[model samples]
Structures are given as C-alpha cells and as structure tokens.
Target: MNPDMSAGSHNGISMVAEGGYQVAILPADGKQLTLYPSLQIDRAYYWTFEAKADNPGDKIYTSLWGDRGAKTIPLTSEWQQYSSMGTPNPNYQYFYFWSVAAKGNVYLRNIKLYDAQDLDIVVEKEWR
Candidate 1:
C-alpha cells in the first residue's frame, strides 16, 4: 500500500488518529495527488476513497475541499461502502475525512481517483 493517495496539500490535515481523527492513510509529506491539468470550472470529475471501519458499527464520512467549498458525504455503520462525485474547480486542492464515530481504529482499504464522465478508475499515487 502507498502512503499518499491522489490528493492535494494536507497542510494542517493528517491521516493519523488516536481515539478519534480523520483515519486516513496519509502521506509522509503533506502533498498527495496533484493532477497534471488541474481542475476546470465546468469539467466534471469524481474521486473515491474506499475503506472498512475497524468497527463495522462505527460511522464514517467522506469530505472534499475544492475551489467551490467543502462537501461531506455520510457513511453507515455497515461493513459495506461509501463514495462521492462532483465537478470541482482547479483552484482548490485538498480533501478531508470525517469520522462520525471514530472511537477505536479504522483501516482505509484504498483511495482512488478517476475521470468524471466515463468514470475511469485511477489508482492511488505515491507521494514521490
């Protein structure tokens, strides 16, 4: 597994948590995925972060930060799944995770990236 996924600057953010935190598989450096072309005003795109909560009964959520603003997608306590999508601008370049019930530990399986329209899947990139 890679340290960083296809994300942007984690400036004050992190992937580590004691009893309750973002619970992400963060990068050694704050900077994660930096798209080549960046985002456009109207170009639609989608990003996905897949994981299984250590406690299947725990609640988790997905968050994204872009030029527009911050968006949060809710998650269930089931051992199933979660995802989100949008047409973000190129200006913003950071994402955050929210834990509804992050009491114990959580394991992030994979954080993926992709094209918006066809939804082509892109593997999570390392911070190198």
Candidate 2:
C-alpha cells in the first residue's frame, strides 16, 4: 500500500487474520487505494477475486492503468466472486480500487491473475 495515499485519518488497508486484506475507506468522496502489479503487453489476463463490503450497496471502482476504462463493482454484505478479462497496455502497471462516492470496509480474498490459458483451470479448482 502507498502510505502517502492510503494514510488518512479514518482510511487504511490491513491484512485480515483469516486470509486476505481489508481496505477501509473514509466516509467521504474520492477515497482510493492503488496497487502496482507487473503486467505484460498484448496478453489477455483474467483477474478474479472474492470481495465483500461491510454494508450492502457499497461499491468500488477498479481498473488497470492505461486500460480502455474502469469497472464499477457492486458489493453486498456477502462475499461474491468477480472476474474480468483484459489485455494491458504496454505501459500499464497499476491496479486500483476506490470508492469515489461511497465509503466502507471492503474485504478481498483469493485474488488471482491468470494467463488466458490457465483461466479454465483456476475456475475449475478455485472458483467451483
């Protein structure tokens, strides 16, 4: 986590005991958390993870830097699996999750990035 951007009075990110991470957002606008992950150009990758928020209706916006656009993921109080497929731009390097308008704790687990060919295996073994 980037301390400078993540260290707000009421917002932060932390590891959870059971496995995974918790991102707490302050109850204000424009709160965000960014993650840097190495990605390759012209390769389609499958991004999958399970996530849940502290409250129903909370949401987070996610995207890969330099990708065409972002995705809005809706969260419920229950854990749910989400997935997306994209080919990163040559200079893409960051993965971001933020609540531009809402605020709450979002828990993430089983986050996986798989090459296109390995996606089916992951789905059969982990997502089933």
Candidate 3:
C-alpha cells in the first residue's frame, strides 16, 4: 500500500488501496493494525476514517476482529467521514479495512479511534 503524500489529506498520509481483496485476513506472523490501550472489556469504542473511491461504484469497508470474529461496516464512494461505535468482545485484537473486491481503488485518511468517553486513543496504522 502506497500512501499518497500529495493528496493533501487531513493526516500526514493517505492510504492508496490500488486493488481490492475478498478478505483482509490476519497474517500468521500476528502483526496487524492494533488499537493502543487495548479496548477495555464490554466497553464501547468509536472508529472513524475518511475515504474516497476512484470510481462511483467503488467502495471500502472495515472488519473488526475480537474473540469470536468480527462485523463489517460499509463506506461510501465519495470523500466523506465514516464512523462506528460498539462494545467489542473482551478479546478484541485488531481491525482491517479492505476494498470490496479485487478491482477498483480507494483512498483513506484521517483514521481515528476513541473510547466511549470520547478520549482519542493511539492507533498505529500498521499493515500486514
């Protein structure tokens, strides 16, 4: 994934997802984009991001994994802010944002994660 430094994004960089993936699986090595201060058990956390697709129908979504598995949230094609809040499983570990399919492109920026009390947590944008 190449970050588009010229996108003039809210953050220092914008993710440029060239192609889509059916599933953003966790790597065997275990390193993934983890939310700092590991979400507390039975507490709600808010997740947000800015995204835009290259084509009108192109899209993206995120899958959040916890003890059981995860849930998905769809994103729009145009540049806009998106968010979700929920009490994740006690074993919540990592989350992944993936394109719809093995086609199209999408750009994402200004990703943020916060707890129920509206406190911003450190989210390291690491890729696997």
lDDT of 3 by residue, 1-128 (tens): 12222322122222344444111222222223333335566656666666665555554545455422233334355667765555666565445455555144555565566665655553434222
Candidate 2 per-residue lDDT, tens place, 12-128, comes to 555444633543443335555565556667666667667777777777666666543367777787878786666666675556566545566666555556666655554422222
Better of 1 and 2 by TM-score: 2
Please report the TM-score between candidate 3 and the true structure.
0.53
Compare the candidates by lDDT and give the number of the best one.
Answer: 2
TM-score of 1: 0.49
For each candidate in the order shown, give its overall lDDT on alpha carbons: 0.44, 0.58, 0.46
RMSD of model 1 against the true structure: 9.4
Clashing pairs in 3: none
Better of 1 and 2 by lDDT: 2
Q: Which ranges in model 1 have alpha carbons more than 4 Å from their true place?
A: 1-37, 66-81, 89-91, 120-128
Best by TM-score: 2
What digit string (tens of lDDT, one per residue) describes model 1 on residues 41-77? 5655556555554444544444345533233333333
- Candidate 2 positional error at 105, Å: 2.0
Question: What's the C-alpha lDDT at position 55 in model 1?
Answer: 48
How far off is residue 78 in model 1, in Å? Answer: 8.7
Could you tally the backbone clashes for each prediction?
1, 0, 0
